[model samples]
Target: MTDFQAIGASRKTANTMELIASAARRTVKAAIPAVPGGIIRTGRNAWRSGKASKVAFLVDGAAYFSALDQALRQARQTIWIVGWDFNPDIRLRPKQSSETLGELLLSLADENPALQIRILVWGMGPVYSGKSLRLFRESGFSSHPQITMRFDLRHPLRGCHHQKLVSIDDSLGLLGGIDLTARRWDEPDHRVSNPVRRSPDGTPYEPVHDMQSMVSGQAASLIGDVARRRWKKATGQKIEPSPVRDAAWPLAVAAEMTDATAAIALTEPGLIGKRGHYEAFRLTRDAIRAARKHIYIETQYLASFGVARELAKRLKEIEGPEIAVLVTKSSHGLIEKLTMGNNRDRLIRRLKRIDRYDRLRVMYAVVPDERGGEKEIVIHSKLMIVDDAFIRIGSSNLNNRSEGLDTECDLAIEAETEGHRQAITALRHRLIAEHLDAAPEDVRQMESEKRSLLETIEVLNCRERGLRHFAVDIAHGGTTPLPGTAIVDPRRPYWPLHRLRLRVGRLVSVFF
Candidate 1:
């Protein structure tokens, strides 16, 4: 009961505290999934972990436009929209509201004097589009000085600024492949004969399917940061973030997950060289590589041999998971058809050869025509679902341009528990159901009954609003795109030919 006894007791307490700290560290390490390497990390995705108080996956233009309208109506301080394209005349909510996007923005600015609206759109060449200039001249967007718009031309030659994001009050954001433009508003029916599917000129466009996800809280702040950096880079003018306290989350759209972790990824010119930023590409590859049961992808183009190789490797595994890729039946124009279609065919053949176990299936979604025939529903959505554990939706396509040439942004969410996994699976089912024109519950039931995703799809497919198998004759050595076609669908900026001089320049570029 002297100094010696007291010293011994103090040492014992210290040892116990150290043990507790060590055990805590082990538990924390076990909670988070290990960062994957090899194929995924090799690409170097610019992945930054962020928090989302509320997250919702909105499918198709109907859901996206509706939710966006609701959020815009609630905006208090600022609104920021960054996209590959923008059509001011597009109706924000065709049925619920008669307001067009430009009109809505103007009205919001009028009502809220303190509100600032900034828009950044790609400076597409006339060969691709001149719609942005026409919109500014004809639409009422130019009438409002409070709303600032800029065309983003800051990119490598042949590259485009292809990220589509909308941030409201720096507390709510939406990001994905769907641009707020014309020919992007259709209900889940995806009815080929739908009257609302017509453009501003009353011309009917083909049916299309696309998706965008909304996030609130800290996640929105991170997206706002990205958008501001883009605005600065494109315009060389810095903008301040909004000071809104409450997020403008749409009341009508229910939150899919609360307190979830969301990762923001990017693809930029910086990622092309030795020291690069390839977060979007890396995250995508890693997610596919990490899949254990199934992989579902919806894309507009499939031209990247690197991505194709990764899939082929997985398909060649003895007990590999099933892979389902949904793409548009054909590209829009003749040149696009010749290039994108040819590339798609070549990749499918390569994957088919490695799919000795029949684990890979490729199909194009379709909508029913009024005359009892089926019409192609252009699938422009960039999405990937991996075994109910990971969900990625963004503007980046599974193509070489998106990987190295284009400026792109994407976001991903990884579920950590069984309940979360069920939510992810349900979201996938809902998307597939929308494409198939079947009930989400029905899709879930079919998938449960049949272990194979391809089998479930084969059984549930109907003549009306169904999927059509993609079959192409295996090319002798994979079809190479025609010569001048590269100028149209180039992996880099197209250089104009000036006889011998230009010919020499082109040759040098090809060799380099």
Candidate 2:
């Protein structure tokens, strides 16, 4: 099983809305894998599983953006974009064209009167806009009649709306961690300096690494359904699901896995007469527990205590699966260093201390620079693969907030055939190869020879542009976690909405 926006660009058409689902459904308190223990199951870890005719994984920002732009250019009916952040000014193909994201959508709307473009992002845009340089396009988005944007004030508490998805015409889906914002476009090479990688304002940022998956058929429609529900809740308007009549898969990209069933898991905090759900968290834990050989993870954060506890237990087991975690080691600014960085370091220390079997390896990626040195590439992807048995890709960070505080969604695929298993293993190997600058077949052969993931990596790692294992005493991130960790990385909702409603009503009666 697999587990898994900021703000208004313009205030003219910008409005904030509360997230209150119609019903107060009780939380499904099922254990990891439920009773009999399987990877993907509804009412347990996954909300639903839909069929996919073709699944293609875009490895980096360049591939993903290009394919997305291509798909958006071909859209016919509806466009749904749900993210933690969004920027209408950023260019999808900066080198090839100067058309910004806003212009593209507006142009699409102009082309087809039936087409509707809707974007929903987290309401707390100003909180992250400054640090992340999220563009606030005043004249953008709302300039067109068919293009609309809204802020989703999800949960009555300190939770976030963090799902990242883009669906077109209910036939093609682009689901991943990479948001359509500034400072996120980069090729697989991830050069230390690229003029074309600059933001809309000519500000150069560090190289970024992320992934997105393209799926066609019923699975893509399922993703559209997710976007529709969130849109309806945030804007209080129901949008009909488009029929999968068109061939919507991007023609430039090739599918890696065919005829696969994908499980869509979600995490929603308990609020507004609605019960909390942690299907993403449960799916992740179950996937980890189900691993028999190896577990490879790429995450932006590593501060979830529940996840850490399960990983620690697995590492302590003599015959447990080997784990390899790839994280970013760079400059995210002072605030991040003080908060998320410290929490991550604390978990890193614990994981290191408990990895008795030496089965765990935590590392960062780097690319060769022109100055004869290596510069680390930012790792912002949330991916996990368990010994080719399953693969997951989505927006859920391995942090406390992502477990239940935020609204999260993920797509997981379980290998049901020999070919599926091989494809899963191939993807893992391909990612490793990308990091190490080695060929996928070479990585596969090395692992085959070594019979261990750690050994294979050690054999492939080089002095330049390769993965660097984290030292026992890593720097920058403090050794001890800072105080008020819960404030910054909360694991649950801050306030129950029903309680807030009761208090508000009492106040109104007294005053009015």
lDDT of each: 0.77, 0.79
lDDT tens per residue, model 1, 52-112: 8889999889899999998998988889999988888789778766778888989999998
Candidate 1, after superposition: displacement of residue 334 in Å?
Answer: 3.5
Indicate which candidate wins on TM-score.
2
Residue pairs with colliding backbones in model 2 are 5-83, 5-84, 5-85, 5-122, 6-84
Deviation from native of the Cα of residue 254 in model 1, angstroms: 0.7
lDDT of 2: 0.79
Determine the C-alpha RMSD for candidate 1 after optimal superposition of all C-alphas: 14.6
lDDT of 2 at 11: 21
For residues 1-512, what per-residue lDDT tens digits would candidate 2 score against the true structure? Answer: 10000111222123222211111121122112322545888888998888999999999888998999999988888899999888787899888999998889888898899898888877664357652223334555565678877777645456678898999999998898888877789987787889898887899988888999889888998899999988776666788888544846777888899999988899887765677778999999988877778999999887777898888767665466899999887537776686777777777877766554467777889998888887889999999998888899998999888998888889999988798888888889999998988999999999999998877887788648788766555333444456887877788766646367435434532331
